[model samples]
Target: MEYPDSEAQLPLPTLESKPEAQITKLPTRPRTVFKNQLVDSTKSSGSAGLANKKCRARSLWYALYLPQLSNLDPSQQEKYLNQLAGLMQSVSSTVSFHPQALICEIRSSLKYFAGIDVIHQKLQLLLEEQLQQWGLLDGFLYAASPTVTGSLLLAKSGHNTLVYQKDNLRSALGGLCTDVLDLDKEQRRRLHNMGVRYLRDIWRLPSNGLCKRFGSNFVNQLNKALGKAPEPTCNYIAPPIFITSYELPYELENLDRLLPIADEILAQLCDFLRRRDLSTSHLHFSLLHEKRDHTEIHIGLRQASRSQQHLMLLLETHFNRLTIPAPVIAVRVEVKNFDAFFGHSNSLLETNSLDATHYKDSKLIQFIEELQARLGEDHVKYVSCAAQHCPEHANMQLDYRGSSKPRLKKSSAGSISRNPRPLWLLQDPVRLNINKGRLFHRRVISIISGPERIETHWWSGADVRRDYYVAKELKGSRLWIYREKGGERGWYLHGIFA
Candidate 1:
């Protein structure tokens, strides 16, 4: 409560008068550990495995950096934290302890466990398990996430498995002995000299000069018990990453025109990723397009890729409805989650696209993407099979653009036939009504081929059931035509030789 109550005082380990703290520890003696799904316990808690292996397991894991280590030397604690960090992915802040010690909290093991008790127990076991090698501080383990308040800890005594409820967390610690607060000997003497005692008393201080002068240790402690502040049992992770942004020159409604700008920033992101050797698995794209919709496009990558082109493709595809909400203003791309580029090690199969070699393809892609800029990406590409036995597969399409690129794909038949495809087929199949199969379209049927059956899709309503004839025309050329044999009666030029 670091406030002005006229009775302002700091609690110390050896109170000058052996006075109790005014603060109230949450009652823990009667607490029954119950699972609280709200808290993600498994990932940091290492107790689940122990429970699985042994019927009952109890271990105390205390998350302390070098300074927090009451027993170990400061240098030794730092050395151990560094060693432990190699094995554990931790998130913590290390500050020099007054006694010249350091502190770190490792919590990567909690996700796999079920409850906090199990996690706490497992962490305890881990600390004790490694005490012989690392020389820990009594192998005691405390549970809590970091809080905006302070780095103070909320600990559960013993090594037994026990679940933790969201509401019960306060009581479990409130009932704790005031000693867990661990006021310094000097601070204790100072407080005891004033005849003050108990966490409840010190916590009740008003917020004003006390907090302004003494700092946040008091408020932070209360926040820890109240849980408004997270006391995570984590180790030192990385510092929070920062992203840069620029103001848009103008509002951009077209996803296409924004490509260059996006490319520019994406290039920057690539550089950052390369430097960090990281790949963004998920990203958030903010588009302040126009007066219509200032949208945020959240994309989950099918595969984590740091490639500029791949990311562009995904973003371009997503702006399907990226109409300018307010005539387009600015755009920002932020990474929500990132992972180290796992397999970016040198590989021959990796696609290489330097500025010089890939310039043409990049330009081509850019040009093809222009339509997506002008008109929403509704009709970029269409997929239509050519001849039944063609090698080219689906023809170039502008309508089937939005079909998502699948992760796993199977082969499909060719759109055009491989039977000597023509160099220049008329857009509309030419009509040369044959007289009893007499050819005209530049060639005669010196040799006639079978009348293969062709059918149209029924659901689309443009049904076509025809018998196609491959005939060498009166001239020295070959042609293809389909004479509707079922519902319609007409000879239409389906295709012709080059």
Candidate 2:
């Protein structure tokens, strides 16, 4: 490659002006693989030169590239990148996103997870697993280096490369084509016309000539990739709320087809919650139908949780009972409510503390959620003690959807007495025919205990004053009977004891 003459005063062409000068064609190359290297902590001569100056410490970064996703829409590509970012955040906090790649700095996380090699293996396994689940595992590449630019460049080369030493940076950059460089149409055409096909060709020319032709920005980018200059990268910030959608390749009408997709999304959702140390009480799923209609399914939990198994179980139960109105072309999952997770710890020895209660309560809540999901929420009901004096009105049925721990009314002066209540109570008292001062239905009934007086609810319109007793019938059945103190003055059957 010949360097342009400094004396030749020609105006550089702006990328916008020469639209047709873009490199529309390029040579195809096979995917390359580079061995992994442990980054050395010792400062190099190049780094030591700037050690006297205030330079940021070199951190190891890995770049992930998905070549197959290049043809996808920008928004779709970004969704995939965001999903990857959420997953990467689990292993490392510092993750940066690009148009076609993700850069993650895992230096600080190395020690906590053993070492870089183990982290690399774990990340690779996780990435492959997630990609397989998403059905996009082919043509995926990644590269690791101590510099962000280097890792990005190597990754863009469509290679699984890992470069640590400064000496190997040139080799990695040399293997890449000019298309990997951040250049527009005019600059790329000029480079190709000057016989600059590979990055190595750019290195052969004089820096001053290249600077004069392409301006200082091109040289700065090159220096950053070579680790001769500092490169600052913005870390990815996860959104406070999670709302992601997945478009199916074909409209799905069956539960089997839709459930796998939902499972994948829920897995990612669980990971997102786990990364933030949070839990969600409700998840709203909107199914986009083929006719442009929306069918919404909401899954609510009795308690906020991040457990994927529990969430999946509830979703499966709901889906089993659901009937899709139309074919769904897409699905969106959103978190309706989220809260910080203050996890519970179980005690080795049983006690009456909140933890023990919480353990039992969690299991009960899960059972209730499963039942409500399978049956309609309205079908399941909880019985709670109400603020009424009468035995028939003392307890009421509550909708299980919003039912928490039953807050039974404390023993108040007007509350029901400590006398034992029957397991079953009739909605209306049935009048009993008494003959010869003995109760009779089909046979003669004998009194098991003496009558207990009861009087209350005088302030309300309905005033009750009665004397109650427990009686035994011919078949060993027990009956609760009460006689009106004033009014019709008849005997009535109120309840039956088990």
Question: lDDT tens string, model 1, 1-498?
Answer: 111122444443231222222321112221112111133334433554434333222122223323335566668665665545433332222222222212333222344444445644554555556655654444443344333112234433322222233344455444444554545676567556655564545545565744664458855666665557644432243332424344555555566877777777777777667867888766777776544555777766534668888777767776665554465565656674777675523347765665345555445545555455445456565444443332222343345332253222234343344444444445666566566666455545544775777565645576657777676666466666667776547766666565
lDDT of 1 at 441: 55
Best by TM-score: 2
lDDT of 1 at 100: 22
Please give the lDDT score at residue 382 for candidate 2.
75
Worst 10 residues of 1 by lDDT: 23-32
Off by over 4 Å in 2: 1-239, 344-360, 378-388, 396-420, 431-446
> Candidate 2, residues 1-498: lDDT per residue as tens digits?
112112243344332322111111112222121123333343332453344234334466888878877888999888888877877876676788877888988655665676666777777777778878778854467888767888888888877777655667888788789998888899999999999999999989999999999989999999988988877676676655666667676778897777767777788788778877999999998988876668888998878888888998988888887788888877788784788896877667777577778788888888988998888788998787766667777778888765455666465435666776788888898888887988886567787885888788888878889999888778866888898999888988888898
Cα RMSD of all models vs. native, in order, equals 22.3, 21.6
Local lDDT at 442 for model 2: 55
RMSD, candidate 2, Å: 21.6
